[model samples]
Target: MLVSLARVASESGWVRPIVDGSDVLEIAGGRHPVVEKALAASGEGPFVPNDLSLDGQRRLLILTGPNMAGKSTAMRQAALITVLAQAGSFVPAARARIGVVDRLFTRVGAADDLARGQSTFMVEMAECARILNQATPRSLLVLDEVGRGTSTFDGLALAWAIAEQIHDVVTARTLFATHYHELCDLAAEKPRALNLTMSVSEVDGRVVFLRKIVPGAASRSYGIQVARLAGLPDAVLRRAREILANLEAQEPADHRHKQLPLFEAHKSAVEEALGQLDLSRMTPLEALNWLADQQKKLR
Candidate 1:
């Protein structure tokens, strides 16, 4: 394995990363060796290189982009480079400087523990819990799609809380790739968190994956475009587009409600309903009926 790795490093022009004891990681012109080799074998043009820099002040990256836009590839490459550097091997980058990590944790991809009767989300949460509990300030963590197996609200909530914990509590050097764009808000709240996204462009109404990492969050996931590329039936694609448009149209109202506190927003109505309740004179059956009426109003 060492000999083959050396051969690949030499043939592909990989560089020797500078391993240090400080809390900093910097990579310039980094490429995934496997992907580069595959592209060379297939003559599919040169791979795009991206630069990453992190330190004690910015220890966590919240990466968001459309599916298959190289988010996962870039994140994996960073982790691989870190591991190679710590192992005293050359990494696939023009330049790299990585701090020594006490532990490396990766929560990527999805699978079920069928033999143990666990669902996909259960497996995902189990791995997530392990990382949260074990990761420390000196650990390196790469998490992709951390809460994707659950409902949108639940997934976003989980992803948000996890990002906060990793940033505020664990303080690990992390690369988090996720489809939940709302998680990008962490960059604004946490000094140690930053946002990154894979670059994409459009030409003649078709999406093009630039495969380049850039600062800032992606505005949309472009799932329909990806579905179209995957050759989904035209009828289904059309229906999806329509549904997407309606959902987007409703987003403003949804966002407004999301911004409000649930209890505070409903306080006036609750007070009014309570004012109508004659609790002192009400019978047990009357109280039950009033409770049922209030519950129906809530729904």
Candidate 2:
């Protein structure tokens, strides 16, 4: 095993990580090994490398970005490098010096246990509960889109509270990726929390993913633009843009008191119309028809 690791490291230009007993993590130009290898094999340019710095003082990172911006990739690479160092294998990093992590916890993606009658949100909360109860100062955590399966306000509240708990109590090194851009307010409230974002750029009026993690909160989720890129019907994209603008106009000044779900409390005619939609099974043509019906109702 040792011989094979050495050979791979030599071939891949990997570096030796310093795994001394410190309570800090400092990684320079860290790359995801599997991704780098795949990129090389596929001739898909080069995998972008990123740096990470975490310690007792600044252990929580709030990562916000649009979809497919490489937030999960960055989080996975950091965890893999630390684990590889502990396993006595060279890591894919220019330099690495991290303490021994007692445990590694991750809560990313979505899943459900319908056979057992557990909803997606229930499963998400259960895994999050495990992290909250078990993780410690020496633990490493990677979380993504916490509280996303629920309503907007509910999700924001839960995500905010969980981030606070992790920073104040667990004190673990955490990389949290979320769509609730409101959570970025932690930089002012929590001294130990830092905001980071996956960088993207606009080229020729098109969004180009830079695949680099930079310090600061993202201004927007860019969900509409991303959806358009995914080839959603033109009619659907137009309706989405309209709804987004309406919601933005109604959003509260304080992010914590976010607007309630569109169909709750004060219902806009459009939202009330959309609320009746069974989007899960709706065909594009049906969706277009629904939108036409809603527009006629408004008129």
Candidate 3:
């Protein structure tokens, strides 16, 4: 796996390695070295390098960044340096010094094993479980977008718990990438943890990624920019804006209030509507009023 990481990093041109203690990882670089290289070959500049260091003081580093801002690339480059160093080959970085690791675990890039009849979420959980069960103090664990397979609250809860375990229980050198900004509070409380993020800029109402890693927390993820970059239809983009407004206006998931399932609420309304249907007993005028009331209720 480390070899694979190195090959990808070598091709990308921007994956530079940094050594702080016994750990070896790339500084600010792309996520998948292979993919980054391909883009560079087509004349795109590589992402800006961010600050990544491993001092024995902090074993777990939390990476926070907007989508497509190079969090994954940074993760991949770190893994690649490990592979290159172990193979006794020159790495793609300016420098590197590696700590010995019994095993390197990555929970990035998960998909369903359909041939095995497993759900994507199940596969994700399985990978996470593997990390939690096997990681040791000397291990290097990279987890990307954990708990995205479930509801927001469930995912956040799982991410928070997993981070806590990785820090307090496994005590491994970890790089955790997440959209859950709320988890930054853990860094405030834990001495062995730190928060870092990719950089972004705004120009003429457009956002550009600086790709630099800096010490701090991410403010927001421009999901709309990512969607537009993916070539979403204009109408879809407009509707998405509407949906985002509604989502944002809703209560935050971290709040104590319980959430109701939309599908279950819809089903309950259907059942109630069915029970209200009594054609035999209703006069025409009364039936019209009842229908109108039901329509209002549905709305």
Tens digit of lDDT per residue, candidate 3, span 1-299? Answer: 65765575565443333333464443432244465557778878763443467657777788888898888888777777676556655455555556766688998775999899888989998888999999888888989989898888788878888998998999988999988887776787688999998888888867888887788889788889898999999999999999988877774762424434312222465567767788898899987887788788879
Error of 1 at 38 (Å): 1.4
Model 2, 144-165: lDDT tens per residue? 8999999877888788889989
**Model 2 steric clash pairs:** none
Candidate 2 root-mean-square deviation in Å: 15.2
Q: Which stretches of candidate 1 lie over 4 Å from their true place?
A: 259-299
Rank by lDDT (best first): 2, 1, 3
Candidate 2 residue 246 Cα shift, in angstroms, is 2.0
C-alpha-based local distance difference test score of model 1: 0.88
Q: Pick the candidate with the highest TM-score.
A: 1
lDDT of model 3, residue 32: 42
Instruction: Compute the lDDT of residue 127 as modeled in candidate 3.
Output: 89
- Model 3 weakest 10-residue run by lDDT: 258-267
